[model samples]
Target chain A: MLELQDISVIFHPGTIHEKVALSHINFRIEEGDFITIIGSNGAGKSTLFQTISGAIAPYQGHIFLHQQDITSLKEHKRSRFIGRLFQDPLKGTAPSMTIAENLALAGCQGHYFSLKPILAKQRQQMYEALKELNLGLEERMDTKVGVLSGGQRQALSLLMATYAKPQLLLLDEHTAALDPQTASKVLELTDKIVKKNQMTTLMITHNMQDALTYGQKIMIMKEGQIIDVINSERKKDLTVEQLIHLYSSKTNDYNDRILL
Target chain B: MLNQVVVIGALELGSIFAIMSLGLYISYKVLNLPDLTVDGSFTLGCAVSAVMTLSGHPVIGLILAFISGLLAGVVTGVLTTKLKIASLLAGILTMTGLYSVNLKIMNDSPHISLFDCSTVFTPLSVFGEYGVLLFIGVVVIVVTLCLHYFLKTQFGLALRACGDNEDMVKASSIDVDIMKMIGLSLANGLVSLSGAIYAQHQAFSDSQSGTGMMVIGLASIIIGMAFIKKDQMAYQLLAVIVGSIIYRGILTIALQIGIPSTDLKLLSAILVVVALILTKVKMRRKEVC
Candidate 1:
């Protein structure tokens, strides 16, 4: 379980250009809950992810994971349990490293100081994992990831993030860079991995249909505040049109790009 | 224009410098850091080796030199990572500070001679004419093999990845700062070790001996990498060794052509610039086609 209490983030604080990125944001996420977040541009979606992942410290708030306060933890230290993926596919994996080597890095995350080589057993495990993706990446385990397509890289990035079965996963527009077909493919893979691991995930998406179709709940954010959260029961019968109507009715800000 | 002895001497010098090139391989190639501390740490190694050799502990001198080099590297690493200084400026600052530190290590003397003192290679002198070369060759090979295996380890993978993609490494729960520190420290350590050996081999240690050492290392890497064009660790390291020898050969040829010894540093700088320009032009040509 994770909880954010009175979280507020002010960018460029004390300056004339100061803006409240996130204001008094509070939420409690249950174990294994898949929550899809929807918002227009500058709705503090990515900023919320950064605050949760310790990438950006909150101006005022407290965060608790498994009932322990983790607000002051460093980003790398918090990464032991929290897996995060960026919007840019290129930001998530080492381009110069081979697929096998990248997987080895993910597997040996906390034990990074070990002098042991990537053993044969570990290589076999990575091979089987990649085979399950059915992308034929297993055959190219030694290939440098630089030449991989955006969708392929995102799929690989998802695999690396969840390889250790992190307790909390944050996806900040992971598939926004891919073509429609590739984005949907990577999204499907993400859904499968998150379901298989029963991981607690918070995914931000601009596509209204995706937010409606996936996840157990839909969270609507406006002006850095949670306006509404439709539960699993309500989310089952929610339509994209109805969700968009609910968003516009509460925030009065409508954008055609979110329909995509 | 070259004698057999001069060729052999060049090979020996190449092998000794190859150890230093291996350090540069880690910093410049693997870590992608243009660490200018090489000039300072190289002399630090020489100073420590000289002082230790004069005290009748030649082998211990080499170990101390490597350790001192590691410390110098750590200073640069701290400045870059902890203090948020630019990497280039950090290296320059550390190099400048190490000048006084290096002299202090030498009891404020700018030069020291080991004419009567024994060195790590002294014991191997029994093998006669080829003894020094053989000893240096073994040392280079051992250092190369150690680095090769180290980079293959899981920890080494993290370090390499830290250079390749810092964000990925941090997200993977690896400390990028610590990795950079380790890379810088090891690079300087090996470079210092090379200086220690050079001092003993040449029978003298001079504070000015480290000038333009960074360019020399870069020249070796550039020349060697152009040949292999492969990403494998074994091949890459082999390229560095070959590059060092080739670089030394180029200098030998320059000397043979009647270039004064005093102008060797200028020649090295010119060679590096030419090599870099050639690489850029070749890359542009490839892109055009």
Candidate 2:
């Protein structure tokens, strides 16, 4: 469903502050694949996600989505096929909108905007989706999102990210900010929805345990290098300490030059 | 006699100021940006609409006013979103540039008058004595209602999102740049619309009409919000409308108590700053308590 070939991204390439964030990176994922990426700080985790989502152009390489080259597409254009969740809870959803209003925006994707109100049918559909989250947020169809709790907002954001039913979901630590229990619950909801929808997903996580436990594959990034790629087969047998060992050894030489 | 004019002056001036406040609501309330372009675009609207009205085509005058205001707004959006200029500086620059643009657009005429001219409201004025005030009132109510309807639509939701959370909207696959452009256009439309109405009603559009308009709008919005606390559509809509009326009322009462016309701008500025501070302090106190 997604492919990145020999992608090289350098920031300020020739300037005094020039640094390589991603260097000749190659990666691939099959359709219906859910890949969890784990990386320490400054390992270009976010940058990698950005590159895949076309937030930033990869300095060198072709990005393919389902087969078409999408490297040159702008973030908004690529967004139709991709859904993203940021680490910051406040960043993932409009805080001042009703849940339904936010969902309506996502629902209206790829359609020409007219002077009409959100259709009654679309609102009913949104209500059903909100109800399924089990957050008791469906009643909040008219509530301003700014008044929602952080966890609720993040969940709503997750729901919005999926509202348009994108081909790929990129979760950039979506649950990283929630209380542990809320985080766990959100992840559970994520699992259920992603499986039901069979969405091709790539989620970056700082939580090593989460990386190992969720998703069909686990990939460790170290200094812009994919130190190890483990499929469900390998992921099942892996442990956190062992994965850390692999990451340190493979990326030791580039640790000093680590760039996010 | 002077006191009577102050009563009339307060309502008339307040009504005009309401126009700016309504525009501010779009940018600040809906879009959540401290857009400063209004100061310039209000004048831009007045300039175009006033000139066109004086030339005997007030409908075209208003349309041109809105279009020109939209252009000024786009320039501000580009400066901030595309050029990465700071919000405050972008507004200041736009306002400065508009001085020259207004001059050129008006054939370097310092002012334009519609004393003998026909405006969008000319036909409505067959009622005679109440013509000017009635025209302004109808314009405000109609435009506000249209905006109320517009803000309830899907596109409006996205525009609101663009204000509160750009990332989420982007994640949802909505383009923030396009939203910003459209938002600014709509916001400035309200401001320029006010300017257009003000031009015809006053029978003159001076380059100075738009000066300090931002402050006046803020004052009205702050006052309006003070009266309406619910986040529901009706409340928000009511807040802008009532806030405008009350703001004008306060100015009227103050003028009745003997404040000079020359100090109205100063009074408006003080009104805005004080209202802003009061709201901030109230919110803070609520959080603390």
Candidate 3:
């Protein structure tokens, strides 16, 4: 389980450009919880995820993963237990490196690096993993990742994120850049991988349908706070229309553009 | 006879400089760090080697030269990574500081002559004219093979990743600072070794010998890249060595064609500019295609 106690992230605390990105966000995530986060732009959703990943330090808070205080851990150190996929397809992978090399790097996550060669056995394992996606990436193990399409790259990113079997997985709008069909395919793959590993996943998505279609729990964020969290039982019975009705009533903002 | 002499001399010098170019390849191309410390480290290598050889320990001289270069690189790496100084500025600062350091190493002398000293090449004296060539050729080959294998390892992949995408590297749980330090240290160490070898070959080490070394190394790398398919890492390194030889050939031919010695630096500057422009034009054409 992960816990955040009085997490507050303030950018430029005293200057004129001072902005409260996250204000005293207190939340807890149980083990094996698949939570999908939905919010408008600048609603502190990304900030919340960043705070948890140690990319951004909270002004006043303590974060714990399995009762181990990770509030002051550096990003690279925290990466041992945390896997992340960025929204930009280019962000998660090294373009100039080959597919097999990237997978090799992923496999060595949280481990000491040696001068040993990437063995054939390791490459074979990676090929099998890529074959599961059915993307034909297994045939192009030596090809540079720069030449891959956005969807293919994101698929590889997802595989790399889950390859090391971290304690938590964070996907920040990972499929937002792909076309609708590709996005759905990636989403399906995400569900398959998460369920297979029984990973504790927190996915941020703008699509209300996706927010509803996947994940066991749904948390709505607004103005740097978790305003509403719909649990599994109620979430199963809820529809997109009812969710929208609740959102409109809670914020009193009837703009469809804001929710979408 | 004159042409043959020019060609042989060029080959000898080219093989020596090829080592330095390989060092630049690591810092500039692999780490993507613009390290100006190369100039100072080159001189430091010469100075240390020359003094050690003068003290009757030629082999120890070469080893010390490499160690000194590594120390210099570590200073630059610390300045850039830990202190957050701009990489270029950090290199420049180290280069400037090394001026005095090199002078001190030579006992405040601007140059040292090893005319009667026993160098690594001395054992091969029976071969006469081909001795230096054979010695340098073997060194370059061993260095190339070692580097080729090193770059294929896991540490090498992480080092390359640091240059390609730092965020991805950090996300993968590799320490970026340590990688940078290791890269810089390795680069400068190779550069100094080249300098040490050159001093032993020429039987002299001048403090000013490394003034335009960075330009020469860069020009060699650029020239080599132009002649080879650069998609593969091994081929790219080989191309850099070939480029160094070709660059030396061109320089020797220019000198033979009656170019004054004083204008050599100007020619080096112009050559770098042309090489850079050629690379840019090729990239633009690729984009258009």
lDDT per prediction? 0.91, 0.81, 0.91
**Model 3 Cα shift for residue B190 (angstroms):** 0.6
Predicted candidate 3 versus true structure: per-residue lDDT over B187-217, tens digit per residue: 9999999999999888999989899999999
Report lDDT (Cα) of residue B80, candidate 3. Answer: 96
Residues A225-259 of candidate 3 have per-residue lDDT tens digits of 88899999999999888988876776565766645
For residues B25-138, write the lDDT of model 1, one tens digit per residue.
999988999999999999888999999999999999999999999999999999999999999999999989988888898898899999988888788879987899999999
Per-residue error for B258 in candidate 3, Å, reads 1.3
Tens-digit lDDT track of model 2 for A1-260: 78899998999989999988998999888999999987777788899998988878888999998789998988888888898888788887777677777788878776526667988898899989999999989987888888898899888878888888889999998998899999999998888889999999999887767777789898878778887888788777878776666666666633421221
Task: Show the colliding residue pairs in model 2.
Answer: A95-A146, B224-B243
Q: How close is chain B to the truth by TM-score, in each candidate?
A: 0.98, 0.91, 0.97
* Order of candidate numbers by TM-score, starting with the best: 1, 3, 2
Would you list the rank order by lDDT, best first? 1, 3, 2
Best by TM-score: 1
Which number leads on DockQ?
1
Model 1 residue A20 lDDT? 99
Task: Compute the TM-score of each model's chain A versus the native chain A and list the values.
Answer: 0.98, 0.93, 0.97
